[model samples]
Target chain A: MISPSIFVFAPLASAALFTALMVVRSRNVIHAGYWLLPCLLAVAGLFGSLEAHFFVVVQILIYAGAILILILFALMLTRDVMDPKQRQTTKFAPLAVPLCIFVGLGGALMMARAPWPAIQAAAPGPAEQTKALGLGLIGDYALPFEVASLILLAALIGAICLAKAEKEPAAPEPVIDLRGEIELEESVSAGAADGH
Target chain B: MTANLTHYLALSAALFGIGLYGVLARRNAIAVLMGIELMLNAANINFLAFWRFLAPNSVEPQVYVLVVLTVAAAEAAVGLAVVLNVYRSFGTVNLDEIARLKG
Candidate 1:
């Protein structure tokens, strides 16, 4: 008899693959960003099937929620973001063909050759898994947990500083708006000629 | 047929390769970041599969997955922030065009 999980895994995996393709191939970047939603959700579903409950939640919350919003925000900030004529892929994309072939073949070969241990028929229950996870985080892995938090703190500060607009009396705008300056100069010259 | 360890490994490998193609081929910086995220997910899949098939009793893999998730979030945040900064100074997000340091 076919395992019941095939019903879920098959559909979820296919959807994820489809959305990932859309994310890469779509000319419209916003559409690609939107497509990322289903792909991420599908991955979460896969995590759930593996009985990684906490990861499934975090995947939905962080990947599907926060990261996606950040991407959309960045996309919106970009000028001509919705332009359909924008090229999504580089000319060097063809180079990926050979790389992919090599990688695929190598991965398949490795999977076939390696001897994986036999899997147990049952997954640990959610409560037992969560308890063990909590104890490990608080006990043996405490130092790493604290270090990870510090890294996150540093990342937060770095991101804020990088994205923040710099203020200085020497320059009103650090980034010289060249297009605006050119337009202003043209208008001023045109006015001078008209005055004469 | 059962959804065995080999099956998940195969799927993860496929996803990883696709993500690699995306990172190498895409011109948009954000799209490149998305590709990186995909690769990370594939790695996470591999971790979970190994945990389930090899050592279901240990919570080490789950903890590792959590750490990876946290790192992925921070990376995305910082990456997008850098992208925004680049956009501000360069006025474009096209990686090919943002070659100020090109020799």
Candidate 2:
């Protein structure tokens, strides 16, 4: 399988570990979003090691390239991206500490009991992978696949409506309040002069 | 280095656990989405590993991973959209403030 040596795996593993931690701990939401890039790249490298070459490309293109960038852009669009009051990373450390240890034990248990796949007669070459997958999706899986796509489209339409609805309601209230405040201040001064 | 089932299983388990921690601990909706992605990825590793080792010569595992990848992409799209809605509704992406299940 022409795999790289342990040196490559170990560092990549450590980097992934560090980045995942940083992903949760970075208070600046944008910085935390950026951490996903290294974390994802390391995983994509792992996919390459596993001989899932196509997955590696999709991982880089879809996840690191697209999703993470969108997340950062969203963070920037929000006014309070990392305001001090909303400290994302300030004291979340203690709550999850023991939970992490328990999770490590559970992972160990899962490793011991993992079901290995039964033998296959022949491995599909990577070149044939896309073709085979496309055939499966449209063949036996077509009905379910199409239904799921319809559901997704419905959801997309719903989201657009909700985002649009919010903007129209918020615009008029501020202008109405500004005019009321100016009139109210003028009324209070005129009343004071009449009393004097 | 002979690749064995145990090595792959260990990798999958570790990655899944990291993902689990991320899901439970991360406050940012995007980070939680990333955690979910990691968990799906851990499953993919196991799928490909099984195809490589046990089913030494089958197209099924390759196809299985492809389906999984597609599903994960769809899931991420839906998940990100939901996170955006949540941000618009609450003005913050922190999940702790939005404990209610209903809209």
- Which numbered prediction scores highest in lDDT against the true structure? 1
**What is chain B's TM-score across the candidates, in the order shown?**
0.95, 0.92
Per-residue lDDT over A50-164 for candidate 2, one digit per residue giving the tens place of the 0 to 100 score: 5666678887897788767756665676636446356453245466656765675577577668675443344455677656656766887676567656756765675456445
B28: Cα error in model 2, Å: 2.6
lDDT of each: 0.82, 0.67
lDDT tens string, model 1, A93-154?
Answer: 88996896578557856886787756764667788888898999999888778878987998
lDDT of 1: 0.82
User: In order, what fnat does every candidate score?
Assistant: 0.57, 0.26
